[model samples]
Target chain A: MAFLELDQLSAFYGKAQALHNVSLSVASGEIIAIVGANGAGKSTLLDSIMGLTRVTGQIRLEEKSLIGLSAAGIVRSGVGYAPERFNLFPYMTVRDNLLVGAYTARNNVSDNIAVVHKLFPRLQERANQETSTQSGGERQMVSLGRALMTSPRLLLVDEPTIGLAPKVCNEIAVALKRMRDELGATIVITEQNANFAMTLAERLYVLESGVVKAEGTVDELRNDERLTAAYFGH
Target chain B: MLQIIVQGLLLSGLYALIAMGFTLIFSVGRVLNLAYGAYLLIGGYIYFTVSQTLGVPKVLGLLLAAMVGCLVGLLKYRLLVKPLKGNHVAVEISTLILAVVVQAGVVFIYGDSSKILLPIVPGVTQVAGASVTYNLLAATIGSWAILFALYWFVRKTHVGRAMQAVSMDTKGAAISGVDPDRINMFTWGLSGMLGATAGVFFASYTQLSPSMWVAPLIIAVAVVIVGGIGSIIGTLIVAHIIGFMEVLAVAVIAPELRGVFTMLLIIGVLVIRPQGLFGREEL
Candidate 1:
């Protein structure tokens, strides 16, 4: 069985349904990417998986049903999610933000802090600074570092490269790849940046208007002229 | 002159105790529990009924008061704050109504006449050639101890940091495996307990009446507004500023004009800074 599975998941925001009968699965340690245009339910999928939004369907992580769990429960069950916007607490210092990430694991907070600081040296340098004053790249580092503090097995990152420069985007993409390769974390990244997604993702799903339009290996999608035509309006 | 300084310090301690409870609820729940002052009244009356009237032990009276406060907080969160769900204006309105209701209930139980509480520890001592009651001294010392412990708890303890996380961002806190609901419940309980404790001290310092809750509520509101949200040091400093201001006004100016300065200070601070002196940032 897949390490994580979603079967026919449907979700809504108040009256309007955002996702319709979406199903997907990821094997352990797989790097899966969801590529879509804006408003394509990319965020909704991650939100549903994190239990931030209500959904009606079967979601199982390692065969443990996640339908009735709260967001905190989902996190404790080994799912780490970083939302589209870098949601670091602006008023809190970097170290405090990192400390908050380990709220569920009080015993190993120091060890986790050491691990995260090693992963991102910039975070270590600016550990005492308030998050509001950090540069965009640094803020993203703090967000990722905070997520990593949970020591997650499956990491769901939504639009990590949003509103960042190419250099910063490259930095984030490299960090994500390193996280997967080194930490053995199964990563599901949602992106509108096709070039970035194509480079790092082994498997890619194209979502459009709340439905998956295409799914394939990166090389397979790269070879399809029609797929490029559809996405870029070529 | 010495009387003003000594009284100011004693009043500041009590003010800090009162403001701490309000701060806890505001920080964790991210809303003003307009009914927070009612906890103090409930605590005071409960102590009065159990200890003074029924001849129960004073310590047990305090504990009973704290227990009542805890129940009131839990019920308020479950019945009022939870149902309202992030509607700040709604929670504020409902809690305000709840406070008035609690006050009325107190009137129904205890007659409308204000009752002077016998000092918990009766004695007097000369400080700087001024006679000071041991009751005020005990209240001040107790307030300082509680404040120090609270500050340390928030800074060092794991659960306290979780409360801070929820205060900063509810969704983010949840994502980090900190249950916001549990934190909110814990905060309300703590707030209620502190309020009740402060109420007991406040009643002994002044006198107990059904309407006693209103003045302290206003004082807490002032401290929160002037300090801003989620600032512990700011709350403490603002509490002292208000407390000392009241003491100074009573000493130099007319005693009737003490609260007037506090109101002016709030208005002036609101007009100028708005976010408060030490407020971190707008939430």
Candidate 2:
């Protein structure tokens, strides 16, 4: 069985269906990417998994169904989520933000904080500064660091590179790869930037208007002219 | 002049204590608990019944009052605040109604006549040729200590920081694994304890009656509005401003007109800087 599985999942927001019969699975320590255009239900899928949005169907993490759990319960069960909009507590300092990640796991918080600070040195330097005052890249790092503080087995990141400069995006991409390599954490990233998503993910799922249209390795999808025509209108 | 300064400082401490709880709930829950004044009324009555009537130790009375406040807070969060689901207007209206209900309850139990409370520490000390009651002094000192402890707790502790995170951003706090519900509960309980404790002191400073809740509620509201919402330091500063203004008015103008200047101050601050003297742009 896969480490994480979403079987025939469907979701909606106030009568507007956002995900329909979406089935996906991730093995242990695998890096998976979901590429799609805007309004393609990438965020909604992540929200459903995190229990921020309502969903119908099976979501099993190691055979334990997460269909009815609250967001707090889901986090306690070792799933961490970082949203596309970067939801850092703007008034809190970077260190405090990281500490909040360990809100549930309070015993080994200092150790987890140390690990996050080692991964991102800039966070340590600006630990005392309010997150609202941080740059986009730094704020993103703070968001990732906060997620890492939870010591989650499964990390769900939505659009890590949106609104970022190319250099910063590349840097974050490198950090994501390092996170997978160093922590052996499984990651599911939703991206609009297909090239960047392709570089980081071992496998890709292309979503269009709430449905999975195609799934393959990066090179396989790149070679398909029909996929490009559908995605990029080329 | 000396009396006014001394009285202002003492009164401001009580005002700060009362407003602190209200501010805390607003910061974390982003909703006003209009029933917050109910805590003060309940606390004062509980203390009066336990200590003054039943002849319990004054310290024990204060503890009983605080415990009642905490219980009320937990109940409010579980029954009222949570179920309302962040409906600010509803919460405000309901809480205001709750305060009235509590006032009526107090009247039913204790009667409408005002009751004089024996001071927690009875005596008077003359400072600069001005006599000050030891009860007021104790209340002032207690208020300062509680505020200091609260500030330290929020700034230095783990749960406190989580509360801060919740106050700043509920969704962000949740993603960080901080349960907003838990934080809200804790904040409500703390606010209850603070308000109740302040009520005990406030009742002692003046006298206890069913309508006493209204005056403190107004004072708390004025402090929050003028200080701005969700600012601890701002709350402190504004508490002093209001306290000193009332003292000055009572000394220079008329005792009956003291609340008038406070009303004007609230209007002036609201008209000039709607965000409050120290409140953030959004709150």
Candidate 3:
């Protein structure tokens, strides 16, 4: 069985359907990317896996069913999600926000915090500063740093590089790679920036209007003329 | 002037305790728990019944009242608030109705007459020429101790940090593996425990009756409104402001005017800065 599998997944916000029979799988210790436009259900797909949205689907992680689990439950089950909006508690210090992320992983809190600080050294410098006062890049670092504190086997990040400077984006890309290489974590990222996704993801899935339109290795997807024109804009 | 200062300081301490409990629920849950006053009513009556009637030790009675209040809070969250989660209006109205039901229940058992709650520590002392009871003095000291403890808890502990995170952003906290539901439940229980403890002191300070909840509810509301939402320091400061204002009005102006300035202050704050003096900016 694949490490993480979504079988015929359908999601909804109230009566409005978002994802329709979306099926996909991710291997263990691999980095995958989902690329799409605004409202193309990329974030919705991640939200479904996190149990933030109503869904009728089978989301299996490590042969265990993740359906009907709460968002916190999903995290405890070793799936960490860093949402697109970078949802750090505005009033809390950066360190406190990261500590809260380790709420379920109390046994190794100090170790995980040290790991996060190493991954994003900027977070350590601003440990006492409130997240609300941080810059966009700094806040994004805090968002990902907080998720790292969860010590998840599968880390799902949505739009990790949106509104970020090129230098900061490179820093994040390096950190994410280190997260996989050093931590042995399976990583999944959703992005609108196709180039950034291509550089980091070995395999890619194209989502459009809540359905998986295409999936392949980075090289295979890059060579397809129809896809390049429509999505990659070559 | 010394009398007013002494009286204001003592009364502010009590007000701070009363408002702190209400503020915790409001800040964390982001929902007004109108039935919050009912916790105090239940607390006062429980203390009266356990200590006064059953001849239980006063400390044990206080502890029992706190435990019962905590249970009521948990039950209210599961039965009342959870079912009506998204519809804040429904939850609020239901809480208001629950408060009335609680009042009716109290009337059924205790009858309509008000009962005097004997001082937990029975004595009187002169403090800088102002007459004070040991009961009120203990209440003030106890309130300060509890407030300091709460401050430390919110800043220092893991669960307390989770509560702060949930208060600031529920969804964010949830995604971070801090279960918002569990945090909210913990907050409700703590708020209930605090309310009940305050009630014991408040009932001793005045008299216990089915209708006593109204005055404290009004005081809590005033403190929350003037202090701004989700700020412990704001609640403490505003409670002191309201406390001193009431003392001054009663001592200098007229006894009936005690609440008049409080009302005006609320209106003035609403008109001038609706967010509150220490209100957090839109999250």
Any runs in candidate 2 off by more than 4 Å, and if so which? A225-230, B281-283
Rank the models by TM-score, top first: 3, 2, 1
Report the lDDT tens digits of candidate 2 across residue range B49-129: 999889998899999999999999999889987899858888888889888888888888878999897788899998677
**Best lDDT among the predictions, by candidate number:** 3
Ranking by lDDT: 3, 1, 2
* CAPRI quality band, candidate 2: medium
The digit string of per-residue lDDT tens for model 3 on B26-110 reads 8888888888889999999999999999999999999999999999999999899988998999998999999999999999999
lDDT of each: 0.87, 0.86, 0.90
> Which RMSD values do the candidates have, in order?
2.0, 1.7, 1.7
lDDT per residue (tens digit) for residues A107-140 in model 1: 7788878878777888998889999899888888
Q: What pairs collide in candidate 1?
A: none
TM-score of chain A of each: 0.95, 0.96, 0.96
Clash count list over all predictions? 0, 1, 0
- Top TM-score model: 3
